[model samples]
Target chain A: MISKVGRHSIRLVSELGELAGFSGKASVALPGQRHIMEKLTRSIFEIGVRCVPITLIVGLFTGLVLGLQLYYVLTKFSSESLLGQAVALSIILEIGPVFTAIMIVGQAGSALSAEIGIQRNAEQIDALHTMQINPIGFLVSPRLWAAIIAFPILTTFFDLIGIYGGYLTGVELLGVDPGAYWNRIYEAVSVQNIVNGLLKALVFGIVTTMICAFQGYYTHLKSDIPGARGVSQTTTRAVVYSSIAILMFDYLITSFQMAS
Target chain B: MSEATTLKLRGLKKAFGEQVVLGGIDMDIPLGSHTTVIGKSGTGKSVLLKCISGLMAPDAGSIAAGDEKGAPPCSYMFQQNALFDSMTVEENVALPLREKGKAKATEIKKRVSDLLEQLDLTAARKKYPAEISGGMKKRVALARALITNPEIILFDEPTTGLDPQRKYSVFDMIRSYRKRFGFTVIMVSHDVPEVFEISDKIAWLDAGEIKYWGTPDDLLANPPEDLKPFLNPQLSPA
Candidate 1:
């Protein structure tokens, strides 16, 4: 099963590289990317802006759980103060970005894939080609840049809400002083840590969008063609491929950091 | 309609791997003429159309327009109406304007609105492709073709899967549109009689060669005994 999953991951990346290869060359300006800005703005409104309330709720509950759980474990060492650092590190470095990426993939990524795949299968892509418009520009670039911009914003929200939840659990539930807890959190969570987490969030964004778009556009037997089942399959493949990719990349980056 | 003046094909050949689709085709379409090329199911008719539209390039031979070297930018209509589902009917219709030259939004809208109304699709101007019928989709395809006001427009099997009356209506639309715009129409069709009705000339393409190229009148008068079986049903090859 592990080997098969690895192969699938490689297969997906290979497909994406091949499909977007043409665009990479046809593209004159990486900075001149047109649709990406619009995509980022729209995604910020939809995924980041609209998702704020839910993200806060989820973040708060997650922080509370971490604090409560760590309280028991750290009690053995009489290290209750570690609660702040623990919660901060977990939320900032790991949970926040991963959780949010998974969420967006479920919400927007798969839907985008299905829609584009169906358009491709339906011959709308071919129609665009006939007219000499790049399908990647017309479709893929916006979604990619949007995710890159939007994920980091959402991850920041996740981290903040989670820290607040940690505060609630550390002060209200535990006998820790509220003043002490806030002080520890502020002192323990440095700028470098926050930046690291944001960097991860940005990478996660690119991965989620690229894998979804690539899977959607290339999973089909051919391009510029449309069918209902073909689109469904495309959506399914996109979600699966992206989820696996996120996990694999997480492992590689984390391991690289550890080794370094 | 084979005119000697515009859109000439000389020894056009296309191949996929070793499988040659169009071995060699030589023909001339007159200015503002409708010539329907008829053939059996897989006799490279669509490939020939694709070559003319620049959708597919020929391996050898030249496709020229207006007694010149390069083809004047032409429009192609697919067998499937390749409309952008994300865009509305009017937006889809006005797409060619973006390609030819940038036009003011107001001007593009006006041109799109006129085409939509003419096709009797003004009611569904805001509707998506999924909201419309196949016939309407075909008509939208027609609208998109006419949008660019291309010098040459090629339709790939224009009336495939329509009801008989709708097929006739599409055929009639093809005829009237050709008359109105005065652009050359090179269409691929199975409806031989219908093609004969609108086509100024007909090319009987069989087994990768043109058996005959002449006016429709000449075709009826000198119908090949061998092709009669393929042209009409309930007939056997001689």
Candidate 2:
């Protein structure tokens, strides 16, 4: 029994190694110029175009809430007017990256995982390999490139809408001075803060999409199992892992920024 | 029975955590040949195909193509059409070519049209896989496989779950296309006699080993009761 268990351990490691090698081969096998165009268009449709209205709606509400909440709390300190800086800092640094990524994990990441997983289960990836078409180039690279390009842009959009919402609350609703609000926000927020937030979003996008894709792609490793249980497990694990990873990464990045 | 293409698999082995799927498989899938592998369910017929296609690499053994690269890209027709539910029949057929950029949009559309016409699925081209019938879905998969003008096509239980009419029709389609294209057709199926009709050689796999490998007539006359079950499996779906 002991020997049998030992043998199994060795076998699992070897399979994992092979999978890694295959993944590496796939990553290097890039699509042609035209295929890249199609992938880019698809990414725009999936990540940017489809995500815009949702991001705007969500971002705006979050900003408005942040402003209202901050105004109520800072009123005790005779600083209700500081609502502008509070909302801006929160949206620009924390809420924008985290909330946007989680939202995308639901929207884009889930879609990506489901699509790639179904393909893997259906043997389409195998078909690609047999055809000498690199599945990585055909599947993974487009997604990697898309997340790298789209997430930062999406995060920026989220931040903008959120700030606008907070601005609306502070100026139109709360009767805080507009000039004072912008001045406070501009004074507290710097280019480095913006860069840090955008960078976090970019990294989160890649990590979230990749984990989901990998989970989906390797799902059929447990072949012969009936039902969508495997798919369910993969999707759940993807979200959980991605969220934890994003948080861990967020702290590290913030620390780096603070130190430097 | 032998053909130009040579796919050599030596010391081919694969295993799950505690289960050994393909113990040690040595096979040659030649070009211009119709080889059908019959085995019990869960006996790794599909796994063997996956290994050969490089979808699931075996723990041991090496699969190498003796033919030239881009010698008609080998297309795999999965047991279940494996159609992208999202894409139209035309898009599904165009998938590989679209990825490879082997043809312009006009040419792709043209080729897709021709395939649809040939398979009598022209009217269904705009429909998604879910919207189409199971038989139609299988045909769409076949169309997709043919779209690449493959060097060889590996089919996993090509007619496993179809109705009688669709099953025989699928058989006819598989045979006629192989003749027309002169491409190697390697199929892993349990449809015993139907496979025999199309197969130039038969390899009966049992428990991760090739128990029997010969021509249909050779096996029929000197019948093994072991292979008899596969000789006439219920064509109806389970």
> How high is the lDDT of residue B65 in model 2?
62
Supply candidate 1's per-residue lDDT for B123.
95
Q: Candidate 1 on B1-238: residue-level lDDT in tens? A: 2223767789899888878788888888776788889989898998888787767788999987655664566678888777887778877888767544678778988999998888899998899988998888888888987887777778888787888898998888888878877888888989877688899989888777788898988888778888777766723333
Interface root mean square deviation of every model, in Å?
3.0, 2.6
User: Which candidate gets the maximum DockQ versus the true structure?
Assistant: 2
**What local lDDT score does residue A117 receive in model 2, on the 0 to 100 scale?**
73
- TM of chain B, each: 0.91, 0.88
Flag clash pairs in model 2. B72-B151
* Share of true Cα-Cα contacts across chains kept by each model: 0.37, 0.60
Q: How much does each candidate deviate from the true structure in C-alpha RMSD?
A: 4.2, 4.6
Angstrom error of the Cα, residue B58, model 2: value is: 4.7
Q: Mark the regions of model 2 whose C-alpha exceeds 4 Å error after superposition.
A: A1-34, A222-226, B1-20, B23-30, B56-73, B225-238
Docking class of 1: acceptable
Residue A117 lDDT in candidate 1: 81
